[model samples]
Target: MDVVTRCVHRESSVEEIMIYTGKSKSYVKSAISAAILLGMIEQLNGDIYKISDDCYGILNTTPSEELKTSLFKSRIEKWEPFILYLKYLISGESSVVAIRKLCSLYSFNRTPVQIENLLKNWAKSTGILDATGEIVDINLSYDENEILYKLNEETVNDTNVSLFMINILGENIFSWLYHDEIAELKKAILIFRDHPRDAIQCSGRAFEDVLRRISIQSGVDTRKLNGITQVANNLYSQLDSTDNPFIHSKLKNIASAIGDIRNMAGHGKEAKSMERWELSSTSAIAHLLLTLSTIKGIYSYVNENRYDF
Candidate 1:
């Protein structure tokens, strides 16, 4: 689509497409066919083509309900029991027993190897699961073997941490994050969920990355800001002066708390007054901040709908 977009107002010949996309002639033909099917581009004046107006909006926005449903049906609807078994494993279920039970529930009448093979492909090929069975883009991990399957200690200890990770897996959450930031954020989330004592520091580090990205987008000079507190102060000052002060204040407070916890972690100190629940909640707030930053880019969509973020 990007190549086609570039070719708009000119001829989109297969030869030119091959040069632009660096793909085979067959691949170019297939892409053009799919684009036409989806109404993303249309042939014009016999040989020339152009991107459709609707394609621009569709490319930039979240997937439509029909597209989401079609994707679910193709990639996940039949594999739901496999996901269920993985969730059940978090409760300490045995893999051998779980596989048999899953097969029975689905009435597949297949052997355990077949089930494992099916899920293994899904795990390895798709972003749904990592090589170690960790849910991709979330803070959950799992281990599996011929005899058993179990949730990783980090996941089992703090189930609440998975709430946002699970929900955002297929929701286009990464559209907000840059390519390099995605890996760093994923690593931070794994540590945040798995290590309670280190949660604050992990989230604080992740929040710093979030702010850095926002600085690039909003044209703020992050290099002048020494830390999260300074960054927050500068950002609030730049926001609309007529906006609700109370809402902005809460955001500033959250940023301050992130920096404070990070300092405590740095000094090897513990806050006796704070509990795991509070740390967990802080992580949730960090996740919300990341989501809200992305939401801000699509102001038109936000104005058309109500979003708690």
Candidate 2:
């Protein structure tokens, strides 16, 4: 918080950050790196940093503790190491056991005691665990149904997909996505339970917007791009031939699938004097999950090959 607050007023380098926070150089650097990853700050051209556009409002204001906690939780939802630790706790593992397991899975230069302290701090702040390292709750504001929804044959649940979407919308990843693109997905998630049909349409808009963003970033002339299918196909052709052919094909398929669902949700036809379009809450949830998953995949691929693009 101190680091963010200092940066909010002006761009700061590592030395400035250390002085402002009254911390050692190494600690300040780590904090900066974490803040960058969380999308709370951005490093500028000359190694100076400032508060990110998406996060300036929260850090610049006198944010309440509740608001800070919510922001922190959303930022870290996609962090694999923390998510793994949470899973261990949910499976009834002690804090010590979970820390050990986490160490085995990820390389940590810190000793077990240090890692335990760090994990405990995060857990407590997120309200998932107590100071004693006991489980407080695992839902993290989501209900059981939203977290545990079964999506056909796919093993991934709604919670996992929702976390990924939140990460994207929060600008933790794919920060280049526009404000409206992010807002559409947020609207879809917020209304899915009460307005499934509207949620589906919102999800479709978000998906299309993401594809268009990718196209623009890749230097495609989007002036002629008409719909989701055309934009996706244009992107697929732009991929290097040496890259994975399977992913290229899958990108097109995913975009087509999303476009089909969006069209169905937005427009229904009458056949045999009977209306043929319908959507349940479960179906909307499933579609939104798929949309989030697809966006994550595309963004991950883009990030990995950004230099090539």
Candidate 3:
């Protein structure tokens, strides 16, 4: 109909408007303006234009509430993986290794403590991914031109952690063990010299202290701590027995060693290679077993003396 409409539809322009129509320029211009306002035409230039967006059927269809919510949720889920990737990078690992780890954790079977242990385990080694989901680190030794690289030996792929993590494990183990020891050692003295009721309450308080300590580091692996976590319900059973030396002396040192091992593992003091495969997983298992043994020893004392009259 007019130059703008013709341009929109690819039809002929109103080239002969001035000569063919006696209507004034102002009237033609006003009609074109009104048409453009209604999405009938687009103003490209003063004289050139095209059809507006009224062509597509979905001009302003409103989305449903459920659709909007789903859109928001989808965005959030995408963000989680990205955030995890960023965390891996910020900690100084490579992207490939990060992806491997990110790929590893699904909030399914892992707690924060386990994740922390695993990451720290890898930080000392190499060939792990970084934040951007790319291979970024290397696990090369000091030897020049003599290191072999393997893909699966990266951080997340390693089945276990390092020795340094043993210290953390051992410290927690000792804390639990020491308190039980103190309770057994002081039970009689306090019960006889002061009030038996107060002794019982003090012993309860000692247990409460244990629970508080456990709560403080809620991220630590409870499974890795089974070794020294056992406690005899009654302390009087052991003061007259042969187990006194084991509990107060030998076990104390053993618990202390577990913590040291954990510290060494976490700090990268015990990272070494294996002949057939890379060496992060098995070593971690050994350290974990030591911790478990330390806890078991504590528990064994408790079990053996659990019914002691």
Q: What is the C-alpha lDDT of each candidate?
A: 0.50, 0.69, 0.37
Q: Which model scores highest in lDDT?
A: 2
Position 270, candidate 3: lDDT: 38
Candidate 2's C-alpha runs over 4 A off are: 61-67, 78-80, 94-117, 138-188, 194-198, 201-258, 265-283, 289-309
Across 162-212, the per-residue lDDT of candidate 3 in tens digits comes to 111122223223223442443332341223223433333333433334423
lDDT of 2 by residue, 181-241 (tens): 7567766766676788899999899888888877667666667777777778778777554
TM-score of 3: 0.21
Q: Local error of candidate 2 at 273, Å?
A: 13
lDDT of 2 at 90: 64
Q: What is the lDDT of residue 5 in candidate 1?
A: 52
Q: Which lDDT tens digits does candidate 1 get at residues 1-309?
A: 444454554557767778877889777876676456445677777656676775544333345555533332233312345455555445456655667666655555447886766555544454555677555535344321210112234333222323233334322333334433443443444454355446445545656676666656566677877666777667666644345321255566666666665665544434584533344544533543453343342221222232333
Q: How accurate is candidate 2 locally (lDDT)?
A: 0.69
Q: Which pairs of residues clash in candidate 1, taking residues 3 or more apart in a chain or in different chains?
A: none
